[model samples]
Target: MRFPCPDLDPPYYAVIFTSRRTPGDGGYDAMGERMEALAREQPGYLGIESVRAADGHGITVSYWRDLESIRAWRQHEEHRAAQARGRADWYEAYEVRVCRVEREHGFDRQRA
Candidate 1:
């Protein structure tokens, strides 16, 4: 689902992760894809947007239903293992930001 942020309020939590990549890690792409797939299967996963720069900085914004779901995802063993690998090999650095989105509005072109 694609979420277009319009006149949105702030109360819903947003998980924003920004990372800097390491060299020669072809596996990171595959691992990222797998992680995204897995996340969609998890509870409270709303949606995600992933962007990458030519300089190797990447940002992923994942939307969740609540704080508990975010906490659950953070403590998930599989995610923990991947995060460790990211810190050890794939990513040079990362920052996680959690914020609340109070309200949102969007119109689906397809719906019209």
Candidate 2:
């Protein structure tokens, strides 16, 4: 798998998002792509990884530099709009959890 961000050390933050997608797109795909692009421009965005199962359950983990960055992203007008759209149309159910990374370890086989 390709990693979105490389060389990230400890003491970062991650927003863990898990959700069940609704039956139809309802503009979700467009908005999701837009959000990814917009997020990449944000001040503290590190990277994001996301995947959806054939059954429609999905998980997205977004890395950030700090809690302040997360808060700013949550309060961003466009992001807020997306949240409303998610509640009103796109998701069957969803949950978000934020956690701090105190330590991490990984190796890339391709690099090896």
| Per-model TM against the reference | 0.82, 0.93
Best-fitting candidate, measured by lDDT? Answer: 2
Give the alpha carbon lDDT tens digit for every residue of 1-112 in model 2.
2245677778999999999998988798899999999999999999998888888899999999999999999999999999999999999999999999999887888888
Q: lDDT of each model, Cα atoms only?
A: 0.82, 0.91
lDDT of 1 at 99: 80
lDDT at 45, model 1? 80
Prediction 1 TM-score vs. true: 0.82
Instruction: Kindly list the per-residue Cα lDDT of model 1 for residues 1-112, writing each as its tens digit.
Output: 2334333234667899998888776688788888889888889887787888888898888888799999999998888999988988988889999988887666788777
lDDT of 1 at 43: 95
